[model samples]
Target: MMVDGVVARLRELDGELAPGDGVAVFNGMYLAVTEEVRDRLAGGRFDDPAAVAELDVLFAGRYLAAVAADQAGRRPAACWRPLFTARRQPGVHPVQFALAGISAHVEHDLPLAVVDTCRSRRCPPQQLSADYHRINDVLADLEARVREQLMPGPDPLEAADPLTHLVGCWSLDRARDAAWASAQALWALHRLPPAYAALATALDESVGAVCRRLLTPLVRRRSGGGQDQGGQDQLECSGLPSA
Candidate 1:
């Protein structure tokens, strides 16, 4: 599947979902990032655009598969369950949704995608490292922009805000580094089907746990306990439970 195909699917999803839906929020952010990647690939920014394109498809396929499964009333990949479960919840901030999706995609799907790309291309994970990092560059940019757009109010960290905790806990750099390590591990276990499957399952579940933490709450309580949009709250979901 071309990256354009991934962009199209995401666009369709964005169109289908309500503006405030958590999945839609994440999907919208992802679509923008994918579009940027597609443009860069078309412009010859990557060293090996074909390999990166293949990886992009495989990476996105995992998320799309989860979406399909959920839509079909089946369980999505565990890593994706948090966002989907919280999709209609009243409290989750858009930044939280976006970061949780990022967590699921980067920590769990990325390694598997990298390994799949390697097996399909008959190349080592090392061969794909440069392009992989290049793509990470794009995601890094998205993370920064997301923080600014969604939490652009007072300095979250300086204000001792609860949202500071939620968004602060997720590190794209760490996630990407761990993903590369996982890809190497998955590649090394190519001949060990049972082990590979076990690692994959563990990864899926663990990433789900991480996302659960990220989507915990976004707003902090005000001094007088009055609620306002983007106002302070004990970091409850603004209107939902903090826990």
Candidate 2:
């Protein structure tokens, strides 16, 4: 139903975004991955297409809400603030912005989305596990492409690079596993509204801490206007600064 049309709205938003903004870098990659997921779901690759589609929509709404909040001069979620605040810092690599956005979305919004979808669909978290993991599989596949395309140079990232450590700190597989656990935890705590709310607050704050580190400015800018082939102005590794 709305699944086929969802990409249109994301495309429109991507078009409206300013070039070189950190959010734009992440949103652009997200748009591509969303397109891929939409295509696979439409092609009937998922075990429960309807369930996955609904989950996808619920998950996307969080990111859309953050963007709206920032545009309206309200503070977005703590997890998203790093990307929004550091968008034009000139020293942060685009990949850091992209990963930070993913970290915020997956670590914070994703578990809540899973719980919300379960409540809306009148099912337990276990019922959605099959298709939930399927969607994550899609995300994991696209993440490699996102990193390859957004790395600040034509050369592959060196093994000893500091950026390697930054990227490694947020592993996609581990993030997915943790998100599922959180979803199950939230679902269990839902009947205790106060407990649910407290855990949710903690989740938001903790994920924000991780994302803030991921978005920490990782490079030094050139004194002149020299630019890399990646079109970024980053010149060399600057020690990680306090975010």
What TM-score do all the candidates reach, one by one? 0.89, 0.87
TM-score of predicted model 2?
0.87
Report the lDDT tens digits of candidate 1 across residue range 1-243.
788889999999999999989999889889989999999999999999999999999999999999999999998988899888888776577888989999999999999999999999999999988889999999999999888888747554545466766688789999999999999999999889999999999988888888888877555456554555454534444443222
Off by over 4 Å in 1: 152-160, 218-243
**Reference-based lDDT, each prediction:** 0.86, 0.81
**lDDT string, candidate 2, 1-243, tens digits:** 265556776787889988888898888878887888888987888887888888888888889889999999998988788788888876687888889889889988999999998988899999988888888888898789877777646544442266666677778888999999999999999999999999999999888888878876665444444555433343455544343
63 Cα displacement, candidate 1 (Å)? 0.7
lDDT of 2: 0.81
